[model samples]
Target: MSGATSTGDVLTINGTGLFVDDRGPKDAPTLLFVHGGPGQGSYDFMHAQGDRLAERLRVVGVDQRGVLRSDPLPSGAPLNVQVLLEDFEALRQALDVDSWTILGHSAGGGYAIRYAHQHPASVRAAIYDCPCWDSDGTDRYRLPIAADLLERYGELEAARRCRELAAKPERLDPDDQSWGAMRALGKRYNELFFHQPDNTDALDRIGSQSGLTEDQWRRGVSHLPLLTEMYESKQHLLPELSQPSLLVHGRHDLVVPPDDVQAFRDSVPNGRVHTFERSGHFAYIEEPDEYAAVVTDFVVSAHR
Candidate 1:
């Protein structure tokens, strides 16, 4: 909350401290934002669009159970898909909200989908932005696209590095500098996330502006094990999610392909897909106005 203009608070739920930044009128429809980066905190999203979306809906950006601003989980804490879902439920109950919409970005989409499937009664609707449906899809579809984009953008060295990393069948430990370097390269060449190459700076700026400390960022990345668990146990449970859902993806998204979005549309009973023609992984960042309009329309219509 250091750089946030919105009201922020820390809630101790199930012995873990979760940080939340709440904006907009309290009476407005609530949206719980789940950011990507099994480790990335919600501060970036809050800094980027929290206030903008807050005008029409109460936006609550949260640093997951052990991300920036939140107390770090124990080194041997039990982490799995179900535990994460339970964390969301505890936050919802502690907030005293009957139910809320979930806005999940990138990897966070997995969490949102699973939560909707497991706790349909607590979720009114779900909005996924360039979501990674599952680990298999990401490994099969997204990574190749990302490498291709890097090569096409003249980042040949980055592309080479990525390819080398990809070729390694063994999983790299989260604490490894090589893994972090690969992640950085991926972010650098993810063209679909921004309309212009210069705009890519927004990605890092948001995190810096949000006042995320170095220690917080490191602690967040420590959850790489959780990410690995998600990838290994990934499931295509879209059909099980009964709540209304909106799937938004960039046509050029290297992280989540259009085909995956289409698959999500095909599987979910109440779901629709919107393609950002000129955008990529971070559709909301690339086309904020349009993204907001689409989300507002979808949520409003779903409630009616």
Candidate 2:
């Protein structure tokens, strides 16, 4: 399992083309990254941490089907957890890797879990970074924490605004711009996941440098149907997963609270939770060095 020196071009799998950015030694243990976002691509992960992780392990970041640089599905492509899992299996076979560890972030973590469960023999281990395993838990816990953080920051008006928006069902419709508005308001609150308020600057820098085009963002958001189906069909499968798992979470993550990670820990017999006390949702970004170390240590120790 060796890595390509440069980012590889798009490869088609299951009639859909996806972008893969590969790095690290070709012979090292391969770690495939499944980026968060029902539509977010792999660009940010590559830009921020790919090289660092590559020093020890072969790192490959994938833009899942329908994400940035990946072929978009038809307006109403029939997508579900099964479809996504099949796409991953196709990618694995296409890449010709005997097995690879999986690192899934946010929503991508859900995909990683499913893949590991369905094809446990193909996965060496699973690393979930600030994962969103259950949408109901996310909706239930996120807002109150966001409001509290806002009030602490003296943004009472913003706090009130988020509280009002939180009362409604989370909108997945691309045309309904309220979800965008809610996200804009919640951005600062998400930054609070860092122990230091100033660490939010890192997020801004990563966003600007990552080259994630507006079109890609729109495409990612448009896959609301996939998200809805995931919520409805996948919640029950968490407890049945028995693969080796490492659950990393931020103590203050409003987007996917620690409680959800705890539930994940409770379900998976081989699972263990590691909380970044000073971090929130994006622990990898907020605590990059420690994040890499934790991931490296876990993958090496588990595989050994």
Q: Which candidate is the best by TM-score?
A: 1
Residue clash pairs of candidate 2: 1-26, 2-26, 2-27, 3-26, 39-220, 193-280
What is the TM-score of each predicted model, taking all chains together? 0.85, 0.83
Top lDDT prediction, candidate number: 1
How well does candidate 2 score on lDDT at residue 190? 43
lDDT of each prediction vs. the true structure?
Answer: 0.73, 0.73
lDDT of 1 by residue, 1-304 (tens): 1333335887777788788888888777888999878778887777767887888887888888878888888888877767778888998898778889998887888788888878889999999887766554465454555567667767777566656656667654333233333354555644545665766777777767656578888778666766665454234687777888888877777667556766776788888888888676776777778877888778767666
The Cα error of candidate 1 at residue 70, in Å, is 0.7
Please give the lDDT score for candidate 1.
Answer: 0.73
lDDT of 2 by residue, 224-249 (tens): 66666445435566777766788888
**Candidate 1 TM-score to native:** 0.85
Q: Tell me how many clashing residue pairs each candidate has.
A: 1, 6
